[model samples]
Target chain A: MTVLDIQNLTVQFGGLKAVNGLNLQVQQGELRCLLGPNGAGKSTTLDLICGKTRATSGRILFDGADITNLAEYRRARHGIGRKFQVPSVFKELTVIENIEIARSRRPGLLAALTTFRTPLRGRVKEVLDRVALTDHIDSKAGNLSHGQTQWLEIAMLLAQDSKLILMDEPTAGMTIQETLKTAEIFNSLRGEHTIIVVEHDMQFVRQVAQRVTVMNQGSVLAEGTIAEIEADARVKAVYLGH
Target chain B: MNRTNHYDFLGYVAFAIIILLGVPFLLGFDGFELNTFARYLALAMVAMALALSWGTAGLLNLGQAATFGIGSYVMAMHLKLAASTGNPGGMPDFMGWTNVEALPWFWQPFQSLSVTLLAGLLLPAAVAGLMAIFMFRGRITGVFVAIITLAFMVALQLVFIEEQRFTGGQNGLTGLAPLELPGWTVDTYSLPFYYLVAGCLIVALLVGMLVVRSKVGLVLRAIREDAARLRYLGYDVAAYETFVFCLSAAIAGWAGMLYTLVLEFASPTYMSVSFSLAIVIWCAVGGRESLVWASVGAILVNLAEGRLSDMFVEGWLLILGLLFIFFVIFLPRGLYGLAVAAMDRLRRSPRTEPPVPVKEG
Candidate 1:
């Protein structure tokens, strides 16, 4: 079953057509990689799906519901989570606290005051363990190394209990070893959650991608399995030019 | 372990004890001194309220005094109405002075002490909630929030000043009757009144502490650091921002009521930009990140200002300006940061240790 469906999506910035007539669909529990060079609307496509950037004209259907005009938080509540290009964990708070904020079932004023004890501390610990960050749980997120921060961001996405996860360049600043670990983590998450990850790293993409979509000049140039996409002449000429 | 947080907790307890019990008993303040101290506490309450929004929630509310003034005016209006009970038409002295025959409709509900007290908190909170909705919902933040709030306050001050017939114009609502409780009336300069203000200050401190120590406080700090990240986490960042804003407004309003009880009047000057900035200075000096320090900083600074002004009337403000500059440069975290640093140094020094648990015993 399709978890996300985007039809005739377009985003315009004044005279610039940032995204134009992009059509994409991701099956539930599927791992899809979006590969594009600089300014290919790869990030913008994720933004449109998550309501970070409003579509100039498009329809975004998520889990059989039209969330085209939904507010960002509302879309998130509908089980969509996006990890940004740069690690965006709460720098002032500890790792556990960052997870706790995301793990909250309901983060209302009354819930914050009356709940007294955070019931999700154990769940947060579990998430930290999953991200291999249990040892650094009490440390401030700002003090974390770049790769660890990325892991922490992933833990936050996990803690949110999202049905669909959108990650923008999840392995941008990661080392080869860290990238392999991240690929392993993505492999582990594939069966439970639908993921659309945008990346420029060809090796990381080859490792994690089941199917690939190549975008260029705000439009899809080709879509197929990673092996097929790697062989496409158009994708090579536009994105992987020698 | 986080040594700074531990020190901050201890500092809060020590400050609370000093303000709540030590000063009233240990210092042996005379009636005048006590009344002055009460005023300082009221000021501290307002400063702490500002800290809640500006420090914790990352909201720079430059018009806290407007909410505080509104709270003071509500209480003063009630007192004036109560005192007018013996008048021919039950009209306040100011209303009669403006040649008004009947009381304003807004003044009618304030006649009931309970209603007035509730209005003091709820009215400001409601106003702040509206402002937060407009600003936060639009994602207006940083210096813009400050500009909007400051402009809103200035406009409210003008309204109060222009509507002299009802609000006593620039003079504000004065000649208020002593607050009457079920058993007794509150005398302005009496020990009982000082105790009443002290109780309010302590309650305000407690409420601030409750918020700053809760899981909500952690989220608030997160929001301050990265609200966008929170939005991606499925949290309603704007809603949290509005909640803290209204909470701060309510606290400021409550402090305003206590301020009126101490001063026996409400004035337009209370809502002035200078007064609002002064509240910010107190928080900055005290350590805006720490409520206990924020409150203590306000009271201590005011006390020092009083003494300095008396000693060097013209040069006091110049001295304060220099001190503020010094704090901003050398002590960016304010007095609380200084204390924490001192504590850290003491912890580090070999001389401060107990010789590694002596084996003699």
Candidate 2:
């Protein structure tokens, strides 16, 4: 059951092919890792999949539906959630309020106006508990520590019930302990949610990635299990300065 | 739900009591003073409206006066028509002076009080809705929104000034007949009219509070914090922005109508860029984050302006400018934020309690 299928996807930014003829497929419930150096087009590919950056030419089939031209919000509504490399939670709102917004079924103006906030309390609590942020539910997101902010963003994804989650550098600025905890959280989400993580940290990648996809200039250099990817001659050349 | 929010609620109740009861009775103000206060209250609505979009929805509408002017003109047109009932072809005096033979079709509907009332609010809302759709849909934000709105306001004021036969040009619609209700003819300086303005302010505050407390308000604040993030979270950021913009404009228009009643005319000056910026300054001074304080900012600023101008005469404008700069730099959150900080300090000084330990069980 392929949750995401990118076929010959290419995004050319003024003659520079940021993503050129990229093809990748992730099975439902698979925790896939995208490993690449800077400017390897890992982020660009995620942007294309989430409808943030329109592809120059390609077909993105998500859950077997062609969604290459959908709007970003519409794609999000269809269960494609993205966690930015930088924590981007609403800073002024409480953690609970942020989760409440993510969990909203109808995100329209009238629906928000008429709907009561009390009904989503149970679900919000559960999502917060999953991220180990239940104690800081009432704290403003701006007040959260860096690791806590990242976890809060993950909690938002959980509250959104996103079927396919795309995370970029999920453990970028975290202690080793926090990184391990995040990896454990990712492992716990396996089989219930399909996640694609773009990571630079090999240790974090080794802890969570079931399959590793190494990207070079603009396309996949290699794809296999962690053990196999580490042994690939081409991947070595790309990472070790060819 | 939090201590700060609890205190804010109580503060609003106290403010409401001051406006509804204290001003009218305990202040011992005469009819003239009361009418002046009524005018201040009317202007306060527009300030609060600006706070809703600028502070909550992250839309800096620098052309709020455009909507406010539309509201004032709509009410004034009806009053003009009412006053021209016995004139030739039932044409307003400005039209008569400009050599127009008959009333314009646009001015005809304003003959009915109910139609005029509805148009006062709905007209600004419709105009704002159109502008909001154009701007928000294009993903225009930040200072760009302010610039576009400011340009539109300048254009509107010019239109009012150029179209003399229709909008009375620079003079605007004047010598309006007092509003006639079912059995009573309301006088602007009378107690009933003052109460009418006060009552409208009260209603607007209540409605604003309801919105601030709702999930919509929460989402609006979220939009303000990061609209792109909200978009990726599956919300139509444009729709929410447009909703708040139109709503804020409608409230500004309502205030404009009340303003016409208090001042006895609708002038093109009401749509000026300076007037629009003054509304923003009022919101900033009162604290844009708090609705009650934003309104209070308008009243306080106007009251100070009245007194300072009388006392300083030549230097009042400079003093006001200095005051605004001081608030912008020293107290970014305005008086409301300062008061909240003071309250926090007061609470802390009484007891040096240890921080509560996080419960693991």
Candidate 3:
């Protein structure tokens, strides 16, 4: 059950290729780690898959449907979730409100006006409890701490019920304790949702990642477990530099 | 941040409604002379429209005046054309002044009030729909949107001026016929017109409240604070902007139609930047986020202008300008926001606003 399928996908920006001829597949309920050095198209691949940027060429299939022409929001409806490099949350909205907003999939103008929103509250509370943010549920999303915002974004993704999650540097700016807390949360969510994480921190990647893919120059350089990639001579020479 | 309110927000709204409803009798001794409050009431529709789009949704729409002008001029042209039928040669005074031969195809519909009313509603929406598609789709936000819409106002005014053959140029349209009700020929300046404007204002405010309390409103607030987050949340941020933009424009148009009947004139001045700024000032003075505050700001500011100009015509602009500047600088929340915050601070515990509480979640 391939949840996300990318074949020969490339992204270019006027004489610069950000992603090039990349082939990747993510299965349902798998925690896949995508590792790369700076400018290796890790985030760009996620961006392309999520329809943030157009693939210069190649196809993207999500849950057996070709979504190459879909807009970013349309892709969102198709069960693709993205957590940014920055912990982006609706600052003015409350915690419960933030998750509740992620719950509704109501379409059309009139339905949005007329639809009842009571059922979304239970799901919101459940996600908040999973993320351990129940106490801060009534607080504004903007006032949350840094690590908490990241977890809150994840909680929103959970509430959205997306089968595939794309995380870009979710632990970029966090303390060791916060990173471990995040890893615990990530590990707890492993079986129900398939996630593709683009991360720089190798220790965090090794904690919950089932398999890892190393990317450089917008395509996969290697694929293996964290231990396998860490011991690989090529990865050390090219990425870690001896 | 959620703050506890010492007094009831709904209770205050009810009190305000009581006062507003009682105004006819309160000022009955004066025989509704000029029916000044009715004019404010019509313009309050415009303010409420602005508050919904700008205050709650966080859209900076500088071109509200363009929409307002569209509605006003459309209604004015219709009224002028209707009254000019008896003067012979079949040419409006401004059209004749501009050396026109016949009424333009668009203006011909004014002959029937029914058609004019329809166009009065549709024309502004049509323009806003087209413009919003181009601008919001391009992800134009904040001050750029402001500049572009202000440009729209200036450009629209210029078009209205240059097309003097059609739009009456600078002198504008006048001498409108009284509105023909079911059985009464209601004078445009009479209490009937006042009540009409008041009714429209109330409708606009209620409609705005509906928008603010809808799922669309939730996403709009999200777009205002974090557009990218909303994008990832599977929301069409551009569509939200366009929807709100068109809504604001249409409401402004409705207000404009009423204004033409009340004031009995429409001029290029309706599209002026100063007029636009004055509306913004009204919103800023009353409080941008609260519907009641924005409308109150319009009435109070205009009423003050009436009295202040009578007392000191030379320095009123300075005073008004200073007042707006002072509020935006010191009390960014506007008067209502300040009052709410002040009252909240006075009380340590927050008010429970009913379970489910409209549940816009």
Top model number, lDDT = 2
Best by TM-score: 2
User: lDDT of each structure?
Assistant: 0.86, 0.88, 0.79
TM-score of each: 0.95, 0.96, 0.92
RMSD of each: 4.2, 2.2, 4.0
Instruction: Compose the digit string of candidate 1's lDDT tens values, residues B73-125.
Output: 99999999888899868888878878987987888999898999999999999
Model 2 segments more than 4 A misplaced: A116-120, B27-29, B353-361
Clash count for candidate 1 is 1
**Which residue pairs in candidate 2 have backbone atoms (N, alpha carbon, C) closer than 3 angstroms, thus clashing?**
none
Query: Residues A1-242, candidate 1, lDDT per residue (tens digit)?
Result: 99999999999999988889999989999999998888999999999988889999989999999999999888988999999987888888877778878785776677787644354457777788887787776677777777778888889888888999999989888888888888998999997999999987889988889999989989888999998987899988985476
Pairs clashing within candidate 1: B164-B169
* Candidate order, DockQ descending: 2, 3, 1
After best superposition, candidate 1 residue B50: deviation in angstroms?
0.3
- By TM-score rank, best first, the candidates go 2, 1, 3
Best by DockQ: 2
Q: What is the lDDT of residue B41 in candidate 2?
A: 95
Worst 10-residue lDDT window for candidate 1 chain B reads B352-361
User: What TM-score would you report for chain A in candidate 2?
Assistant: 0.96
